[model samples]
Target: MATNSTVSLSMKFDRTSILGSGGYGVVFRGEWNNKIVAVKRIEKTNCENNKGEDALQKLHHPNVVKLYHVDSDIDFRYYALELCQLSLNQLFNGDEAQKNYQEKMPPEKEVCLQLAKGLAYIHEKGFIYWDIKPQNVFISVHPTDVENVSMKWADFGLGSPLNDRGSFSTTEHNTRPDNWLAPEILQMKENFNRTTPLRQEGTVKSDVFSAGLIFGFYLLKGRHPYGSQFNIPANIVNNTPVNLKAIEEKKHPMHAIIMDMLKKNPNDRISAADVITRIANIQ
Candidate 1:
């Protein structure tokens, strides 16, 4: 059932546990209407007329996280969202000691296909998922069948429309491991003497680049395409090329598609639609 936008505080729900906390806000697990839900509480200052809610309102895709309700009064804003079992980051870096059971990683092809479909849909909707990392990719848990598990794109705090140029700043730190930012975004931080205006925020191709890195991480069992020994930001600024031969050796079938997505030049990168087609062909 669709959640009413005007739900009052009197609504019966139990806050189960804190899901996660970040610079933007805190996410909590809650039981509402006999269903598990994720409730994100953001300060009024951080909520820009509920932009995140507006972005997610019309979106309905299997690979996209569902937003059930948005409620606000004066000082605080709340978003009630669909609850997922695990994030791709959690699955990538499993803690057997804590969880008791060992984490089983999904097939690279399966992960790639789902992610591509989600990204393609976002692009088609004229929005850019500026942040596309394992942490933002969530997986639905199924007790009986691992293959039945599915992935969905979550966390729209950094998302913006394609034409929204002010979403990103050129002076900010660009290449943190947690960010998984594209080379173009990293380059914006560099002092380049360019004749034309540089793009401060991410474009569709920028999202594609991040998607490639995520795909590489999955193929290499959570290891980034660029080795951990070097600073990723420095490598990106220095125009260090990805080692395609090594990637091909690791996952031959996805080599071409991933390579195209990782192209340094955004104009030269393949479209999300093209990526979907390529993935479909391989499947």
Candidate 2:
């Protein structure tokens, strides 16, 4: 029902309560026409190009947050999304609910299952989400019933749609994401020069690395991949052999397959299909 209004300047409401902040923009929960909406006001400098608007509009999936409309004028750029209400990250990582006090939270198995289904749909559409952190997963109540809620992915800033062959590579961002980046992305040799192709900077495998890290983060209770003893910065700089030897002390059922996906060798990593198959079989 929410469509972009080309002439309605009044719909641009000022809702300043901060939802989140990042390198590009600040998200806020605001109201327009008695409806609650979350607005992302990206800097005009970025909006001048307008891929953000096109990206949000192109997304067509139930598991992805829907774009209500966009309001961009000479003064500012506003991207209005259906407010998520809350995110899975805040529920698990915040307060004593799931972090401290040992407060019981939702079934981890169920959450993981939902995560896989959403991912399957995304991959089916030839899209790869570069960032898969918990902070990007949101929970929103059903429009008719506030008590019923659903999980959805948020943030499309760094995400990219796969090309016809389902591949894109990059090498510009060699700085390892430490616990999250896959080994090939962290170590694979690439030809870098002034005229080097852009795809070489990142790849489908890079996304796989990030995906493995999210599942690992889930199984590890939001701790760094390695605890305190290991030096991650050292591993990043030297391009030497690094292992989860630190977190190895703990045994998680998801460890084996996930680590396969995170393998330093891109060819050894599991595909997203394998991830879905594993998710389906997990008890």
Candidate 3:
């Protein structure tokens, strides 16, 4: 385990080998214990108020990105994680998006199953991954066969453990509205003001909805289920009807399963475990 402080602190990462950067933090391509890895560097201030490190240390699942080590200095905290070259979003919008899609890297069913398994594991461990989007789903591709890719959940900065009641509340943090955000979360954005601040309780079911949207996006070939780009957040917040006719019309095997996951009410959505079971039955 990465929890061993001595092993974690001894690891070294190249400052110039940045793989990605965003509001959350910067990820650097690095090596640990003779294996290639990604070193995620975040400010100590963030981790001080975050449970991501705690959650990552306890979660050990094949479907989740493996944390090899944890290192830190005066200003920042560094986490060495399994290196994944591509994200689910990259398959649809990267410069090589069209090429990747043509190659059909990792078939649709496999991707969905892998995602479900990862989320199921996270929930089983009593955590709510508030950030469940295509960008957070990392993919490791084979050098020869793109179809032989592996998917894993990565970036647990917004993740937190569920309370005794099976839910967690966020008073104010890094959460933001996005295309894949669940309706309940989007609704929070509506009431979020400078004075009132942002207070919301999130459950595993919210993750189920976001996961369903990701499946829909992949199956729909990058199209969002909630109308178009401009109105997506609003539509979700308003609980507007989802446009699933494309899958429904084609009678896609996962159509009904996804439909239930996207239900307006959180209680109506199926569990991540149920998703795995349903997918298994179809196969």
Highest lDDT scorer: 3
- CA lDDT of every candidate: 0.71, 0.60, 0.80
Model 2: residue 145 alpha-carbon error in angstroms: 6.6
lDDT of model 1 at residue 29?
71
The digit string of per-residue lDDT tens for model 2 on 1-283 reads: 3433442654544544787766668787665566788877777874555644555577777667877777766655777787875666676567664343223334555555566666666666666666566677777667687545566877645556666667644333433234444444434433333344333444566666666666655666665453433554344334332345534556645666667766666677677777778867766
Q: How many clashing residue pairs, candidate 1?
A: 0
Q: What lDDT does model 1 reach?
A: 0.71
| Superior by TM-score: candidate 1 or candidate 3 | 3
Q: Could you report the Cα RMSD, in angstroms, for every candidate shown?
A: 5.1, 5.3, 3.8
- Tens-place lDDT per residue, model 3, 95-172, is 765345537566678888998999999999999998888788888776687667777998647789999899988776
TM-score of each: 0.82, 0.73, 0.90
Q: On TM-score, who's better, 2 or 3?
A: 3
Ranking by TM-score: 3, 1, 2
Tens digits of lDDT, candidate 1, 13-69: 344467777766887776455667887778888766555677788678998999887
